[model samples]
Target: MSPSAVLHRQLHQAPTLALSGEGSYITLEDGRRILDATGGAAVSCLGHSNAEVRQAMIDQINQLSYCHTAYFSTKPFEELASLLIESTGEKMSKVYIVSSGSEAMEAAMKLSRQFYLEKANPEPQRTKFIARKQSYHGITIGSLSMGGHKFRRELFEPILLPNVSHVSPCNPYRNRKDGESNEEYIARLADELDAEFQRLGPETVCAFVAEPVVGAAMGCVPSVPGYFKAMKAICEKYGALFILDEVMSGMGRCGTLHAWEQEDVVPDMQTIGKGLGGGYAPIAGLLIGDKVIKTLEESTGSFRHGHTYQGHPVSCAAALAVQRVIQEENLVENVRAMGVLFEEELRKRLSDHPHVGDIRGKGLFWGIELVRDKTTKEPFDPNLQLAFKIQDKGLEAKYSISLYCGQGTADGIAGDHILLAPPYNTTREEIVRIVEVLQAVLEDVFGELKV
Candidate 1:
């Protein structure tokens, strides 16, 4: 390959050029068609080349493409906000739209602080945030600071904000005690969070941020039962906001419109992305709960933040169309049905593999953790980069499949897992194919390792 002008994620390797995408597969410039199982980091919930979303964007462009939210609000903007708020059953009264999950998280963090500032009894010392270890929020400085992914944050640790602290993630596979029941484990985690708040001075913390279902950083790990509720109760006890980052798990990725729906807890504020626009356009937003809205209404009456394209008309139109299509086509239902099949197929095929440690997730999002010793639940050595190699092998011409790969599930440098988040409208046949391709890739990779 010739020297590339574009600076890709990997400096040494230029990725293959994609010519087009249709349904669940993308066509490469070289004529190879690879199945898109992970939707490019779980963003393409509607899959590739969605005709409805395309038409909606084209229609919106014909009418109006850009509008400054500071000056005007377009139809798509108002309607998208209304739709999202309605979808939340009015628990969230407003939406602050942005271009990506990182921006949304940044907005959520700022809003949390702003809410406290604008309250009747202002909390000047409430400047701190709490997130979870191995959890990924986003890449922006503020969002990255709140994130606890050690591997991703190591390089920028010196420059990252010092106000954010982390607690152990609600991962049962590794953290759960040998004989501890689910209730006891959740209570223990809650107690730990309460202790952290007290140590930092409860009045000095603004909010506790978490993902209802852990995403890329943890490879689709959902919390143990009652975990979110317990955490929320602790936040309330401390008079701190409960913020949920649903960037990777929301918009029906987890068989529900909101991943929190299944968790039985409503966050005081929530950030959503990925499946929101279904990859039709770059979009994400922060959903404000009634308490925050009330505070702003009584005090500043405005969120002290602004973005050039906070609610781009085209992006809003694309997201609105995607949401409408999900409803019309009952794609969330498909997600629920296909999720069961996918999990069943994954466990049936890979559960007994010598190197496969765990297979877990909900809805269409699933992850398979690869281990060096299944009996001991030991992760592969970081030097091996097993996950990346498996992902690379899966995309080869012989396999022609794509799987989302992640590292540091066990700690921050070891543990390998493959994430599968096929489109919400994915078929049973597609689920089977994904599992088959994954099984083949795993067999080949582990066979070569002689494990």
Candidate 2:
């Protein structure tokens, strides 16, 4: 391969160019069609070539594509916000749209701080935040600082914000003690969080940030029952906001419009992306609770933050169309039904594999952890790159399927797992095929390892 002008993730190797995508498959320049099992990091919930979404974009472009939010707002932007708020049952009173999850998180952080400032008795000292270990928020500096993924944050540790702290994530597969009941484990984690707040001076903390279902960093690890409720109780005790980062697990990805809906705890603020626009357009947003909205309304009457593409009409149009399609087609219902099938198939096919350790997730999102010692739950050495190898092998001719792989689930540096988040509209046949290909890939890769 010749040197390329465009800088890619791997400078040494040029990735295969995708020619086009239809339904659940993407055609590459080499004329090979690969099953899109992961939806490009769980963004393409509607699959590729969605006619309705495409037409919505075209319609918006023909009318008006861009407008500065400071000067004016377009119909698409307003309508999208209204739809999102309605979906939340008006719990989230307003929305601040941005171009990506990172931006949405950045805004959430800023807004939290502003909310404190707008309080009748301002909390200038409340500048600290607490997030969980092995959680991913976003890639930008501010959001990255809020994230606790060890591998992703190591290089930037020296420059990261000093006010953020991390506690244990609700990963029962790894952290729960042997013979401990779920209730006991949750209580322990909640104690740890309470201790962290006291150590940081409870009055000095602004918010506790976390993903409802821990995404990439820990590979679809859902908290044990009552985990979020416990955490939220602690946050409320300390008078800090609870911010749920649902970029990967929300918007019906986990069989509900909001992942927090199942958790039974409403966040003071929430950030969502990925499935929001279904990869048709770049869009994400911070949803503000009524309390925060009222505080800001009574005080400054303006948020201190703004982005150039905060409410781009085209992105909003795409997102609005995606939301409508999901509702009209009852795709969330499909996700729940298919999710059951997906879990059953994965358990039936891969549960007995020697390297398979844990299988957990909700809705259409699932993760299979690969371990060196299943009994001890010892993760494969990071140097082995087992997850990447399986992913690459799956894309080979024999398998021809794409999988989302991640490392550092065990201790933020050593574990490997594959995440499967198929499109919401996936059929039974597609679910079966995905499992078949995944099992084949695991066998081939593990066979090479002589396991």
Candidate 3:
């Protein structure tokens, strides 16, 4: 292998190169064209080619690119914040923009801690956090500590931040039993969370963090009815805050602008990224609720944490335009409508395949869980890397579909599920084509495996 290839590649076995892209297709330097289904980890909500968004970025560049926060805030920054608050309604009053989701998550954790301390709850006792198992918050130390993804945390275990605990996630396909009713299963999971709180001494818990719809870690799994409500109640019963990491599930990916809205609950603090900028710019932010802000305002008067590029003007401008497009185009409504279509079509195309185990998702975000045996729900051996094989086949079929690959969907160590999150404004034709290509690729790869 060349030195650059040997050093920079994430996967040693797979080819790595993105020469350029347009619309939903990415082209390689070798002149290969492929459809981009997952939008590079669900970030590209507006798709790869949007002339207006591109021009927005260019115009902002002509005006100004970067200005340090100490000097002044730009029009784009102010307008973006205003637009976000207006859309999110009165609950999310303040917006602190950052460069990426991990930054947003770190800021949220620090802000949550500061909020508590500022509120005179200086009780050193409330320093612990509770996150769900099989969740991915981010890769930063604080967020990483809060995440329970086994593979992501394996090497960093010893040095990871302390006081983060985990409980069973609301996974029905694998965790739910044959006879367990939905209500019964939910009650069982809620009881397990309450048990964890008691085990940790609720007073020591600062917040219970979770993805409103668990992403990446568990394959775009939305909670089975009433899960988030029950979780919010538990967090409230204790004095802990509720922090929702919507970095992957928020910003209209799940039909609503905020995934928490579907659950009929609001988080004390929420982290959002991905579609926030529509992949037009690198931007993410923490939506601060009234209580958390009030605590800080009354006590500290200022948040203790700050980032150099907390709210860049150009990035903000791009995101502002992105949000405006979503609102003006009625894209969230499109997401809700097409989301149902995508899921229904996915089921029609792949539900009965011999190796297809479970297909679950919400809005435009979906996952196809592959298995060796559907009857027993037995996943193929991890060494087989079934997800990557399918992804390669899909790419060869001329689609740039993203495979949100992860081990441990089955047991935190083995199993493969491919996540598909198309653009919110994706046309019905595009959805149909995406599923069709996926069906063709999956059948080909799995059929070969069978032989």
Clashes of each: 0, 0, 5
lDDT of 1 by residue, 1-451 (tens): 3399998888788999999999999999999999999999999998999888999999999999998899999999999999999999998889999999999999998989998898999988899999999999999899999999999999999999999999999999989999999999998999999999999999999999999888899788999989999999999998999999999999999999999999999999999999999888999999989999999999979988999999999999999999999999999999999999999999999999888888899999998888888888889889998999999999899999999999998997799999999999999899999999999999898789786
The model with the greatest lDDT is 2
What is the lDDT of every predicted structure here? 0.93, 0.94, 0.86
| Model 3 TM-score, 2 decimals | 0.96
Off by over 4 Å in 2: none
Candidate 3: residue 341 lDDT (0-100): 94
RMSD score of candidate 3 (Å): 1.7
Off by over 4 Å in 3: 5-7, 11-15, 397-402
Which of the two, 1 or 3, has more TM-score?
A: 1
Could you give the candidate ranking by lDDT, starting with the highest?
A: 2, 1, 3
For every model shown, what is its TM-score relative to the native structure? 0.99, 0.99, 0.96
lDDT of 2 by residue, 162-183 (tens): 9999999999999999999999
Q: Which runs in model 1 stand beyond 4 Å of their true positions?
A: none
